[model samples]
Target: MTSHVFRVGNGHDSHRLADGGPLVLGGISVPHNRHSVGHSDADVLLHAITDAILGAAAEGDIGEWFPDTAEVNRGRCSSEMLLEVWTTIQQHGYSIVNLDCTVFAQRPKLGSHKLKIRQHIAELLKIEITQIGLKAKTGEHVGPIGHEEAIAAHCAVLLQRTDSLV
Candidate 1:
């Protein structure tokens, strides 16, 4: 009988909004009045996805791998970060099965960009676009996100071991 092992991980990330920047999310540029603040490009969606992939492989998160204080990490593109982390995940003998992600924001509605975001992620992960699920939510004017002060993203990933123990 064939046996398979599956692992699941959840990751979340948030960044404060700031002026004079271009909003980058899911590796795609989104037109907005403000952008997320961070040492990297601050693509919250990609950050969450990277975290989920690392977590699934029992590896540390983005901060540990790419600290804000590191000069090499500053202003780096998040998609590149995700690719590097994905290499680690692949080396651990695991492959992503699927990923579901949600973005929390209060401005510049993301509804229209969902497909583009999903396609970008699918290309990054080398998976079918159908394997990526994207969702957007508003903060309902309750907190930092609600007040348009920040943007957040959450991602859940399922991974399976590709090698057989036999």
Candidate 2:
């Protein structure tokens, strides 16, 4: 029997930097230049990951599920939001096969944190670390990200139907 092969989905997220605490990406808070200001803790990596899984399953974006309008979501951590998205995808009979993500920043040197980020995401998605591809890029001194005033991420996911695992 042919496994139900469907599609690959892409997700992108961005947030501005704020001066207060260190920044958190991919669930691990890195001591960086500035933090992200948002209604939530604003872990941009997790936000992108959540979007990828949701998109792969043809579900709506994060805002559709966790609206900024809801007072409860205010000051919420992005990891928690991501967990909810993963649950929803699984319930809909979809499991992520692999995901490739890119993080754009201008400072703090992401080289030291890539491994931790991979481990964090793998743990969150219950997937092998090999299934995740993470890349970091500098904005080349251009745009908001180049000024170290913002960070953004893009994620693409390949999800397989749960029934096909057999």
RMSD of 1: 2.8
- Per-residue lDDT of candidate 1, residues 24-54 (tens digit): 9999999887989989999999999999988
**All candidates' lDDT scores?**
0.90, 0.87
TM-score, every prediction: 0.94, 0.94
Lowest summed lDDT window (length 10), candidate 1: 1-10
Clashing pairs in 1: none
Candidate 1 regions with alpha-carbon error over 4 angstroms: 1-4, 164-166
Best by lDDT: 1
Instruction: Report how far residue 152 has shifted in candidate 1, in Å.
Output: 0.4
- C-alpha lDDT (0 to 100) for residue 80 of candidate 2: 85
Provide C-alpha RMSD values for all models, in order: 2.8, 2.1
Q: Residue 161 error for model 2, in Å? A: 0.4
Error of 1 at 150 (Å): 0.7
